[model samples]
Target: MGKLTATFLKEIILLARDRSGILVLFLMPAVLVVVVSLVQENVLKTAGETGIRVLFIDHDRQSTGQVIEELLSGSGAVEIVKDVDGHEIDEETARTLLAKGDFQFCIIIPKGVTDGVKKRVEQQITEALNAGNEAQNEPVPLPSLAVYFDPLVQGAFRASVVNVLHRVVLSMEMEMKARALSNMIPVRMNLILQEIMGPNLINVPVGIFPRMDSKWGSERLLDVKIEPASRGGVEELPTSVQQNVPAWALFGMFFIVVPLGGSLIREKQDGTMLRLLTLPVPHVTLLSGKVIAYVLVCTVQFSIILLVGRFVLPIWGMPVLEMGSSPAAIVLVVVSAALAAAGYGVMLGTIFRTYEQASMFGPVSVVIAAAVGGVMVPVYVMPEFMQKISNYSPLAWGLNALIDIFVRQGGIRSVLPEILYLLSFFAGAMLIAWGVFIRRGRTGG
Candidate 1:
């Protein structure tokens, strides 16, 4: 215990003296979390929170255009920009503005659209009512609405805008068709009454049919209920801070390998490792002390990120981070993650002989693991093969465990598998490191 404590203090003194290492461990993660979370929040808001400005050129200038404008404005997902300065936007100007990305998209309502749609719908409905007659009317083509989008717009956002426009147009068509059918039904029934009861008796009560619901096109009988899925049975709202904070913090934790591995290489190159081996203290104790010191640094680093997410980010207009109900679960996962990271560092230090080798490989390996682990992008959104492969990364285990707690409102029981995986990984890494150390002692490498 005494030797372990002394070794621990010695490592702390060494780390504090290395200002650059301290900065990398503490400052880098803080800056990364803040910048990334805010950027993501803003990007998400562009679709809904802040309305996207869309160019609207209504050549129809009739009921069709007016109804579309009213529906889009009511949706509040986008702002309709009809003109530039005081002049109305023509198709050419709208296209030019879209090319320049002045707006994400443009909507052009063709001239006489309302009349053309009404005529086509009434004609189609009339032919349907006159089915089985030898005289069939010619089909009338419906005029189309034109929409142009910027090349830079994302496919998902573009699809969303196009879908809204489709809904609006479909609603208008359905309403117009229903009204036309209502008006034509009485005329068609009067003709049937003349055929059945003769022209003089057409006004008889038998000619009248039941009144149809005029609001069938617009009135909704069934409504869709939206709710979030969560295991804890509480509705959970996903936020960028919840995702990026724990993700980048775990990233910073694994990054401990660079400094920790470099420390080991520095000790060996300067003969400090050789001198330490000659001491009465057990080699295990010395190694344990370094692990403990780095684990503490990892803990502090994670806490700083959490604080930034919970307090600092909210001031910058991001959602305040919500720590899960189980603080103990958070601590347990953080420690397990710290141990996993430290073990990997110890293994790298044991295998590599120079600071350059350790420094370069440590960061690159962590970054690769992080990428596979759903830190940069959610694993569920990745290709199926990548998602299956991500399960192998130790960083994936830590990140999944943290997300379960922070976002899913999970407890230790929920993250037990990940905790076990991380611990087993730590044991395996430490074993490999120990074997390499013993082999080096025997061969004097």
Candidate 2:
């Protein structure tokens, strides 16, 4: 037992003395966590704030053009560019701006919009009289008619234009009704018609106009707040650790196993294992002690990363303990990850006859594992085929179990299946390593 303890302490001291290993295990994961969180935040912001800039070309010099400009300006959602020194805006220029992504939408009021409004007003009044409706009845709501804005703009922008059209059309309809009634009445009754067309009638539609709700505009951007399930509180932004820590920790833990496996191969090549065999110490005991030492190293590395994530990334104040309600679930993730690292180290040590072979191949294994385990890219974003392949990687099992505990707030019972799969992978790798070791012993190599 004393010899095994000495061996464990020796391995720990050796790892601590290696500055390059310490940086790879600790500092790299910490920096990567910050970078990934910032990138994700920027992506979400861009997607939400993407808006169209529109140019308005008004050919009508009449009050109708002024009315149109006023209506457009009322909507804070749109930026209407006006009074360019150029002649009428041609379709060619509009298409060119749209192609260059300068303008997503455009509006054009042709020279005869006022004449069209007058004709539309007369037709509306004729229809109202023919229907035999009482004058007291509310005027029919006008259908919105857009001039030339792209239909593919954000829903808020489209609704803004529609709302402006409704106001303008309603105002024209009220004016036409007043004129029609004045014509029908005798000179003595003209006073009554003029009195009926008071401010109330002209402005009723404006007051009841269906303005676009700002809340509805936000909904189009999918602005949803994600919060810790425990507090029921909301977060304006995702927690930094939530967005960044997993990938870095996973990749770091993976690389840490390489030096462990390489060290074992070196000891075997130097005949150190043969010298140790002269003692009464069992091989399994030595192996288990080595694994425990590596676990301590990995745990210290992970703890540092977690500390940096909490302080540097500062993803909300939700305590790490609040990641999951069950303490056992957290323990299970750590144990499973440690077991997987041990199994991989043992397999690499047994497969290679020399330190050179292990060093050459161990990094390749780590890279492949990182890629398939959603460490390089999230599993959610991977292609379906690649996602399916990820299920076969042991790192994926460990990461999935951790994500279930941290992100989903799952309990031990919820993560049992993942734990089982990870244990199975560890057992399989260990068995292969044992087989290789026994074969080499029989060959006397």
Candidate 3:
């Protein structure tokens, strides 16, 4: 314990003396988080302003088709474009517009839609009455509402648009049914009264149907309810802050490889490693102390970056960090992530032979990993192949874990898989580094 403490203090003192390392470890990540957050916020705001574009082609040109068009045109979330250059678009033209990125989706309301829906509703009610069963019979087929979408559009957004169209069609169907029921009541009631009282007994013909209660008379054939994924009681943070803070922080943590590896190379080249081996401290203890010191440094780095996101950025008129339900889970992620990064640094330090090699390659490799791991761009926005490959980056694991805690409002169990992966990376790198050190000792190199 005493020797480990001594070695730990020695490493801290040495690292503290290096001003450049201190700046990189502390200041660089904070600056990056703020800058990236600002940029992402702006991008999101601009994208929100550009509402989803859709093409509406109405062959019906009747009341039903006109109703749908009116609903879509008035929607703030969707923009409906009907024509180009004072010419109406057909299905083929709509497809062309979609291909050209003029619209995200297309909807075609087929001809005779309003008349067909009215006919279908009449047939449904007549069939139900003839069968002496009010059990909901299947609705008659009407002209289909055809939807065509650009393959490039996101599946989730495309599905949302489809759902909106479905609701519109359903409402139209309901209106037709209500009208059919109203027309039936007077005829059906007169026939029953004539049969009971004998023909010409009353000498009066009924001309009106009594008003029916909407709630009891109207039974919706299709009811669609949408539930969002976010659970209650958990505050969702801004996308920019939730994503950028952890991503940039992970990038900075992994960059500790540059200084840590360079220091090792410097010691090995100057024969300081040989001198340390002769001292009373075991070689393993010496390595452990360096690892411990850097782990602390990484923790500090993580904390500073988070503070900037939570407190400092908000004052600058940017989004503030919204914490998750589990503070303990967040701390666990930070510690595990820091260990993984420090372990990687030690492995890099041992593998590289010179300070120049370590300094050049360590930061470059970290930057590449950061780019792939969603530090620069989100993984979801990347091509499918790139997203699959991003899983291999340890930094990706760390960033995902942090997001689960902070944005997803997940508990400790929710991020166990990511935590395990990070620990495995630490263990694997540390073992390889240990082997390299053992091989060097045996050869006196």
Candidate 4:
């Protein structure tokens, strides 16, 4: 057998002999997956139960203002705050609060609304009479009521407010009309004012029609989109079987190369590497074997998670298989993850002086990778700046590719660029690890 092949076989044998290392690399990921999934589910459920908070600002101190407040408060959906600790809220305070997202909506009632509505109705009546004359038809004007509301409210809530305001205005108009008709005498004299030294009442009618238009000073609601999802659209993996399965799976795959890289560091630290220089086995063969062993461990760990996710959890990721190109995409995700994890392990092993340090750093590196790559939080829900930063991490590419396969139902071609990027990341990380290891050997550092 080739020296490299023999070295790889020896590494695999060594790994099989270490039962504790085998469990850490294999069983831990399954546990992590379960824990993360449960936490996500609970958070999502809680968020859904509590509706958004909104505030009401009543500017009009009149009866109409009271009616508006009553209408809004009557709905169990809203909470009305008339004063904040004995201090009245102003427009500026409302704006500041809204900008901070303290409240989803705010209602503002302009002063003189009742007076404005009355004047507007009179003006509409006069306009109707003129229009009637031009059309040679009897004038029947409608009330032109004005209802003003702030434009910074949410769309759904604003629409509800408008509907309630229309009802109140209609009631006011009906009451005014009833009082005016009741005061009209049986024989109303249209020319009473003419004979009494005035001709202003010559065309006066017993009852005048009020000119009313549904909208006079209404404004559109604020346009804001809020995502009310837990993990902001991140998929839920099953947590019943494993507490930190996903985290472990990701880290386990990554740590597979640690031992391979650790071997060189160990030899240097023990002074055995120099003593072994007299042997026939080449240095390149020893490194090759270690890398191969890491690949094998990563492959096994990945396969176990896939089987558990499929059969045990019954959790089917996006049906990429139906796309006829999912197989290629799946292959790409697995290969990329394996390569990147191996490279990461190698680098950690090379940098650390002892096996304990390499082991500790392995999990730490996985956490950092998950954080930057969006394993903890979804990239889409993250702030725009964070999404930009995530692009630099290999975990981001791997997770994205996996999400495409599971959530977006993207085919192989759709994720080709991501796969290529991951591959490049793996190659780059591996190159760095190789360089560090070789340099350490040469410098005896």
Q: Please rank every candidate by lDDT, starting with the best.
A: 1, 3, 2, 4
Which pairs clash inside model 2?
A: 240-315
TM-score (C-alpha) between model 1 and the true structure: 0.93
Lowest lDDT block of 10, candidate 3: 211-220
- Over 1-445, each residue of candidate 3 has an lDDT whose tens digit, in order, gives 9999988998899998998879867998899889888888865653553456678888988987788887666655567778878998888888888898877788888888878877787887677555755555667685688889888877767777777777676766666676676667667777777888998766346555575544433366677975435545554544788888888988888888888887777788888887887788777787888889999999999899988988999987777787678989888888888888888888988988888888888888888888898878889999999999899988899888888877777879999999899999999998999899878954446
> Which candidate model has the greater lDDT, 1 or 2?
1
lDDT of 4: 0.60
- lDDT at 280, model 3: 81
Lowest lDDT sum, 10 consecutive residues, model 4, at: 316-325
- Candidate 2 residue lDDT tens string, 301-358: 6677667666755454332322545668867776777777777887888788777787
lDDT of 4 by residue, 162-277 (tens): 56556555555555444333343212334444567575545655455343333332222456765433233544432322323334466557656556656766777887666655
Q: Rank the candidates by TM-score, best first.
A: 1, 3, 2, 4
Give the TM-score (vs. native) of candidate 2. Answer: 0.60
Using lDDT, give the best candidate's number: 1
Each prediction's RMSD over C-alphas, in Å, is: 2.3, 10.0, 6.7, 11.1
User: lDDT of model 4 at residue 196?
Assistant: 79
Candidate 4 residue-wise lDDT at 435:
81
TM-score of 3: 0.65
**For model 1, what is the C-alpha lDDT against the true structure?**
0.88
Q: Rate the local accuracy (lDDT) of all candidates.
A: 0.88, 0.65, 0.81, 0.60
